[model samples]
Target: MNFRACFVLLAALVCLASPALAKTPVIGVNQFVEHPALDAILKGFQDDLKENGVVVEYKVYNAQGNVSTTNQIANQITDDDPVLVLAIATPSAQAQVAATRKNAHMAEVPIIFSGITDPIGAGLVTNLEQPTANVTGVSNQMPMDKHVAMIKRFMPDMKALGVLYNAGEANSVSNVRRLKAAAEAQGIELIEATVANSSEVTQAAKSLVGKVQAMYVPTDNTVVSNIETVVKVAEESKTPFFCADTDSVRRGAIAAVGLDYYEHGKQTGEMARRILAGAKPQDTPVEFQKTLQFYFNPKAAQRMGLQVPQEIVESADVIIGE
Candidate 1:
């Protein structure tokens, strides 16, 4: 226990304090459900972070489309004390925001939410231009007018338009309002069926059969998590089901005019990178997709005994099944 021993301890402490030797920063990613769109967003976020030179260790958790489980995951993530939290969907974001409020340590943890359609309506932010809160991220809000127009374009005789969504998702609820307005303006009746979880999606879709001419799905995580159920119902009912997410078109929806969830995730990751680089969430305005894509499934159209309009087929950005 002489000068050499004392010097060795001092050198170890210096190394521990050095930024180069510090442990990789950890980020918590809480996803509400395991759906293709949300999964793509998660992938885009991680990929973008890697591409942007941000080295982060992530603790990913899935809620499996359960609200209670979502809250539990959020609480666990809060307890882990990650540098930042990325909530994938509206419900997950709401749960994480509530959990952080309950945990004093997590209250300061910056949150970035992706795949949310209505940040302001969901109370996730005070304003889109100025968040004024510790939570800010990308919104996957598609244009409802364009969606309604696309449906009408395909089925010129469409009278009643069906909508199946989760009443619990704020984003879906907000989009439903827009859809209703659009329907009213187009002189089309809007038939609504709400589901609380993925298991109810098929029943909800079935309820729309014969009651409406076609079905339009909002960007609701619950409904999209079980999109195949809705698709099966639509196919059996011979009702063309349209979606607000492009990824859903590939999964069997007849068509969609919207942005890709992967792109939404990349935008979310870029915002997270800004947050990590000392940009406060309160100062960063919420971002939205600037471009949209048209996707259609000709197989789905034929299954429903409908013919894709020549104009729509020509204008589609991506056509499934040729």
Candidate 2:
């Protein structure tokens, strides 16, 4: 080919690829757990944002359940000066908030959080529908009304419900309130048993012995970090327990009808994409998942001597190995 023609062809190719060559929207993700529901949320968030034409460059960071480490990691995250951040869980979300709050210059960097039960209660925002600041995102905080429905499906005769949660966490408090309301609406008595820290889960679970018909474990950071202890106690007591997260179901809980946390991440990703597309976080309304998931553990059911209806089991996207 002639030199001029070759040059023209090459120029055309570069011009055509301009949009694809654009710098990806740099985003930092802070996560405290590597569980399935949360993983699903992240996967969905990434896929949705990328599919929407956002060029996102992701740097996934794990906080390892240490608030101090999470805070430190968030500080390091800001060093990259990412255009946006996705905080996966409560601690991760708070870490992002702390990092942004600690530095005035980076205040404009918008954060979209997922898996946070109560953004306002957690002091992340002033309101849900209309965030009055440079932050907004989706929440995988399981709906209490839905948990009530799940309970009825599993144990039609269940009259009393017990909840174990971390009393200090805003998300746990929000969940417990909603859970109590759901139990009330369903005409069931609700019992409260709480732990102050990871070391207190066994004692907390033991406290619920014979006082409640069934137990509901909220997606509290403290309880989740120590699920095995609670599981062991419940197993020994033969008390049927339900988790607020799918991961808990997989690990041991009989079942959980809750938000698919990872999908929550994907949903958050969509929100982040919108902000990256020039939509201000303050202008964008808080997003909620339109769908929920039911994760059941056949093994947990068998061990607890609980009979989960086959229909419900069949409906589960996940049935942990018995």
Candidate 3:
């Protein structure tokens, strides 16, 4: 072959072999912690995107339960200039939103959040229907009334309910306020215990020992991350522990009627795909997980010295430790 022909062949080989030569989309993920539910959400999101042919170069940053670290991670992600940012929890979402607001370039990068209970209260978005900004995603908001009603079904004559949550988490704080109102409306007293971190969760659960008839856990990232500690205390105290996250049911909560984090992530992934396909985040309305899942643990109930109700067991979508 002539020199020119040989050079042309080499150029074609380089184009085919060098992935770096092609423009691959980059997606930045900011995760609050390595909890089961949040991990499930990330898995679902990635699986959905892969199925939908959305191949993205991922840069995942974990805050590891440090709320302050989220701010630093957000700043680092901003520097990466990814095509989009996926914030996995409330703290992660808030950090990315704050970073976006401060940096002009970051402001243009769309952010999609999952596992956030109260986006408006967190100040991540102005409106749920129309975000009016470059941010919109899924909200894992469970029905407070329904959760209270389920607790009533288990402990019909219960007078007081205990709750453990992270006071610093906006999602937990907002959910606790709603739960308090719901409890009051039902004439049930609520006992609250706040924990700053996972290490303090056991002490927080112990504080509620005789105060509440049953213990309820909200979708607090911090509290849920160390749920086994709370569960161990509740089991020893013979208090039926309920959760607002279905995955916690498997983690030893007596039961839960809640959203599935995997499904929540899948929905959030779809939204991200839409954003990648030229849909504006501001125009895309925020979505809520449509299906409510029932998860009951017979072993947990038995450990709490409570028998699993036949009707509840029959109706549960998943029965852990059957």
Residue-pair clashes, model 1? 0
Show where candidate 1 strays beyond 4 Å. 1-13, 16-21
**lDDT per residue, candidate 1, 246-321, as tens digits?**
8889999999998887888888889999999999998999998989999989998988878876888999999987
In terms of lDDT, the best-performing candidate is 3
lDDT measured at residue 74 in model 1 versus the true structure, 0 to 100: 92
Candidate 3 lDDT by residue in tens digits, 1-322: 9999999999778878996776778999999999899999999999899999988999999999998899999999999989999999999999999899999977778999999999999999999999957999999987798999999988989999999999999999999999999999999999999999888999999999999999999999998989999899988999989999888898889889998888788888999999999999999999998799888899889999887669988988988876
Q: Is candidate 1 or candidate 3 better by TM-score?
A: 3
Estimated TM-score for each candidate: 0.93, 0.83, 0.94
- Using lDDT as the yardstick, the better of models 2 and 3 is 3
What lDDT would each prediction earn against the true structure? Answer: 0.89, 0.81, 0.92
**lDDT of model 3 at residue 278?**
97
* TM-score head-to-head 1 vs 2, winner: 1
| Model 3 CA lDDT for position 179 | 98
How much lDDT does candidate 3 score?
0.92
For candidate 2, the per-residue lDDT at 44 reads 84
